[model samples]
Target: MPSNIPFRPFHRPAPDISATRKPDGSLIVRSNIPLGNYEANIGAYWRAAADRFPDRAFLVKCSPDDTWPELSYRTASEQSDRISSYLLSRGYGPDKSIMILSSNSFAHATLMMGAVQVGIPVTQLSPSYSLVGNDFTKLKYAVELTEPGMIFAEDGNTYAAAFESLDLSDKDVVTISGKDHGGIRFDDLLGPVDSVSVEAAFSAVTGESLAKILFTSGSTGMPKAVPNTHEMLCAAQKTLEHVSESLDAVNDPTRVLDWLPWHHTYGGNVNFFGIARVCGTLFMDDGKPTPGLFGRTIENLKRISPSRFSTVPAAYSYLADQMEEDEELGHAFFKNVKICQYGGAALSQEMFERMQQLAIKYIGMRIPFGTGWGATETTGTGTAVHWDSEKVGLIGVPTPGITVKILPVGEKLEIRIKGPNVHAGYYKRPDLTAQYFDEEGYYCIGDAVKWVDPDYPEKGMIFDGRVAEDFKLANGTWVSTGSLRLSLIDALDPLARDVVIAGHDRDEVGILVLLTEAMQKKYADQPGALSADGRRIVAPALIEAVQEKISRYNQGNPSPSRRVGRALILAEPLSVDKNEITDKQYINQGAVLSNRADLVALLFADDGSGGVIKLNKNNAMKGDKDVRNEQADTA
Candidate 1:
C-alpha cells in the first residue's frame, strides 16, 4: 500500500470547504459529497418508483414478430409480492438463499426482486455455464458457498443436465420456468396471498440485509461468491444515477436493448438497476455478443433502435464491421441512441475509431460513447467516463461515495476501492477475503492503471494492464500483455482473432496468433505458403504487413518494450476444451502457455538442434547460428 495517503472518512467534510443549505432546505456541502444513504433497502427504491410510475411500462421483451410484450410497474410489484409470499410460505425467508440459473428475462428480475423484498439472498449463475464440461464443479461451488434454500432454473432441460450429478434433493424447492417439466413451475409459485403478509415481509427487510451472492467467472480458478447487500445495491443505484445526471441524461422512460448475460454483474446490477431507477423499459435481446451470435443482435438492433445501448468491445467491433458493409442498417440501428457504454474488456483504439467514423457517417453525428471500469465485487461500476465526449480509454472520475486509491506497484498503480458499494467479502472464504483488501479497508481491484493526466490530477485514469498478466523479456524489460494484445489486434485488424504474448525470461517478446478464417484461407491458397519442413508457412507479404504495423506501434510508444521482436502465426485456434479460453471467449494466458509448451519452445529453436526448427546446414549464416543458439538457451 502507498504510504502516508490522506485519510478521509465517509461522512466527514474535507477541510477545504464548508457546508451549505439548498433553497429546498437540503444540506449541501461544498467539498464532501454526502455518502449515499437514500432508501433503506433496494426494494424500497423499486417500490417508490413503482408508486410514482404505477402505470408506466417497466420492462418489455421483444417477440418473434418484432413487437413488445410490456409489463407495468404496478403489475410487476403485485406479482413480486405474491412471489415473496409464496417463498415465505415455503419456509424460505431472511438468511436463506435462492440460486437463479438463467439468462436475462423479465421473470428473472421479478424473482430477484421478490427475494430481495423478503430478505432472501438470490445468487444468479450464467446459463452458459451449463455448457462447461466441469459444470458440476461450478454448481457444487455455488451450492456449497451460498447454501441456497431453493434453486430456480430457467429451462428444465438445461437445469436437469446441469445439476444431474449434484445432490439437490436437500434443496427445499426446485422451480423451472420458460418450459414445463416434472418439477414445480415458477408460475405456480405465485398464488392467492394476503396483501398484509406481503407488505409486512417487505417492511421487515432492512438496508443491511444481504440481497444477493454473485460468483466470479472462474476463468482463472474456483469461483468466489461475493455477497451484495441491499445497502450496497441502493448505493450503486445512486452512484449510477449521479453519473447519468453528470452526463446530462434525462431521467425518463428510455428504451434499452441489451443481450449481456444476466449472470454477470454488468448485466444484472448496472444495466438492470440503472435502467430501473429511471423507469426505463429494458428489452432483452436473446443473443450473445460474439461473432456467431452477432447477426441476431444486429437484427434486434435494427428492429428496436434502442435509445440507450451497452455492449462489450468485441460486439462493437462486429457491429462496426457490419456497418462498414451496409450503411443503411447502421443508420437505422443507431438512429435513436443517446449513449453507448462499452465494458467487460478493454476497448481497442482501432475499434473505437471505427465506431466513431461509422456513427458520424450514418447517424449524422458522433455518437456519445463511454467506458466503465469495475468488477462484480464493486457492484458493476466503480468508475465511468462521462458521455459528454467521445474519449476512447478514459475511465472517468470515481462515483459519488466511492474512493479510489491507486497503490503504486513498480511503475503502474494497482487500483483499490472503498465504498458502500463494495461487496461484503467473499462468502465463507475469509482467507481469500483477507487477501483482497488492504489495511485501510480498500478492496484491491487487481488491475494496474495509470493516470491519463498526471498534471491535471482530477481527469481520472486509464487501464495499464493486469499485474498478473504482465511479464518480463530476456533483458528484464516488462511487457504489458493486455496493452500489447490490444496493440497486436489493432495492428492486425480484420485478420486476427486474438494473440498470445510469449517470451517471459526470454531474449525478446514473441507472439502466437490466431487469424480469422478468411485471412487463413487467403494465405492457404497463396503460392509458396507451404514449406518443405511440413509447417504451414505464413506468406512473406502478410508477415511484412504485420511487421510494419508493429513498427508503427513501436514508433508511437515511449519505450521499445512494447515492440515484439518475433511472431509466429498459428494455423490452429485456441480451444475451450484445451482450457486456453473461457466460456466468454477470453484468452487464458497460463492455460495457453501450459497447453502450447512445445509451440513456445519451437519459437526459440536453435540451428538444427532440439529436433525443432531445422537449419540449412549447407548455407548456414555465421552470426545467425549464434543468435539462434542464444534464443534457444533463453527459451
Candidate 2:
C-alpha cells in the first residue's frame, strides 16, 4: 500500500485577478497586482548598483583555459560608459544601431547594456543562423532587414565566412578577438567617457525607446523582427516582481549560473534583465542541457552554487539525474538555492517530483520550483506559478498591470494578453502586427490554457497545447496534445524522453517517443530493438513500456481521443538541421509532422515488422514484434 503524500507547501501569494464575461461569451481575466516602481530603463538599476556596490563582482566567465575572469560592478560601469560614449561619438543611436553576431560572453553583456542603456537599439542575431544553418539564408535575411550601422562578434575570425559576402561598406564591424578580419577592435569602442553627454543620453531615454530587436525562428516563414522597448523589458520585470514574493531575494544580488543565449527573449529579458535588476553576480555558463555539453554544467554546479536558479525543463531533467548520482553536487545545488525556475517548455511530472524529493532529502524542505509562460511579443515572462508547488505545467495568473482574455476556439480556450510588458509591434511589419491583436488590444498568443480549478481562478491555469498545433480526429473528437503528451511522459516515466503526438485526422492518437539514455543503455546489445547510433533506434522495450502505461491510462480515462493507440521509438532523433528542434530542446510539431510523414503512417498501418508497435484498446493490428515475448524475457 502507498502512503499518503502530503501537499507540498507552496506559499507565494497569488496575484489579484478579476474575470469578466465578455459580450461574446469570452472571458477577460486581469490582474490588479501593483508593479514595483522600476527605473526608466533596465540599465538605470545597473548604474545605481555599481555606485553602491562598486567592488562587487558583476559578470564572471570561466574559460576553457582554466581562467576565471571577472569584472566588478565599478569596472564594468566605467567600461560601459566609455563604450557608450564611443558609440555616441560614432553617431550610433535608435535608428543607427549596433548588431551583435556573437555568442554570450562578458563583452556581449557590457556592449548590449552600454548600447541599450544609452538608447542605442541593439539587434543580437542568433548564432544558429550563421553557425548551424547550411546556407546562412536566415542570416542574410536578418542583415538585409535590420541594415545595422555596426556589427560586433566575439571573434572576427570565427565569423569570417559568415560576414565575407555580406555588404558592410557603410557598416562598422568590430571584434574582441583582434584577428584582423577587416574590422575595428572592441577596444576601439572604449574611448574617453563624456559624462555630460552620457548622462544626458541615459536621462533622455523613455519607455518608448527601442532597446532591442530580436528575430523569430523563421521556421514557419520568413522571420519577423519583434521590437522590444525599454518599457516592455522593465515593466515585464516589475510585473514579475508583483506575482513573486522572491522579490525580497532581489535586494541581495542574485548569484546565477545560466547559459540561455542573449539572442533569445527569455535569456535577454527574464534571465539577463532579472540579474541586472539587482546587480546580481552572473556566472556565464558555457554549456547547454544537451548530451555533450551538460557535463560542463554539472562541473559548474559542483563548484559555484547559485542563490536562485533559472533554466529550461530539459536542463532540470539532466541536473536532477546528476544530483542523484553526485552527493556533493546535490548538497551544493540545494544549499543556497531559494527558487528553482524553468521555462521554454513544461517540466515533466516525474522531473518535478524528482527535484522535490531531492530537495527534501538535501535541504529538509522542498525548494520552490517555478515555471513562467510568455512569448517574444510579451518581452519575456508573463504568467508565473510564483508559488512553491510540485505540480508541473501550471502557468499561474497574470502579473500586475496585465490582463489575460480567454476565448473559446473550437475545443480549446485561446489565451490572449495585454499589458505594459507587451511589445509595441513587430518591427517594420505594421500589417502583421495589426492582424495579431484583437479590438480590445490583447495580443493573440495562439496558446490554449484551462484554469486548474473552475470555481477558484487564483489557483492557476494548465497549458493545453498550442491552438495551431491541435488537430481533430476522424470522429471529430479533439485531442489536447500538450496535456496528453505530459500524461504519456508521466506514465512511461524514464522511458519517454519527448513525444510527438500522431493521428491528427485519424481514428485514434499515437506517439513517436524519443527514448531516454537509460533505455538506450539497457538495450545496447539488442540489434533489432536498440542501435548504437545516437540518432534513431527501434526498441521493443520502448513499445512495451509505452503499451503498459497507455493500457493503465485508458482503463482510467476511457476516452478514445486521449488514448495512445500505437507508438514507434524512432531509430533517428529529431535534428536541428532539419529544423525539427529548437535551441531549448522543444520539438517543432509542424516540422516533425511535415518531415517524417512516412513514420507516422507506420504507426497506423496493419503490418509493421518495421518497428511500429500497435498498443491500443481500439483494434490496431498487432505487429510481429509484439511485446508478449519481449516483456516476459525482460521480466
lDDT of each: 0.68, 0.78
Q: How close is candidate 2 to the true structure, as a TM-score?
A: 0.93
lDDT of 2 by residue, 388-422 (tens): 56477898888777888988998899999888889
Q: Write the per-residue lDDT of candidate 1 for residues 1-635, one digit (tens) a residue.
A: 22132211112111222334346432222213555556656777567668878887777776557567788888888888888888888778766778887766667888988888778889898665555576567777777777887777767666667766566667754555443434678888778766887787777777788888888767667778888888888888877766664332235357888776667777788877777677767788766665456777777788878877787666776687677897667977768787777876666666766776776667545666677678889988777775344346667657677777665677566777778888757888999889998777878868877766665435556787788878887787888887678778777776665678887898767777666544666775566543334243445555555555555554565353676655566655566555576444556777887788877887665433221222122212123343344334433
Choose the strongest candidate by TM-score: 2
Model 1 lowest lDDT segment of ten = 6-15
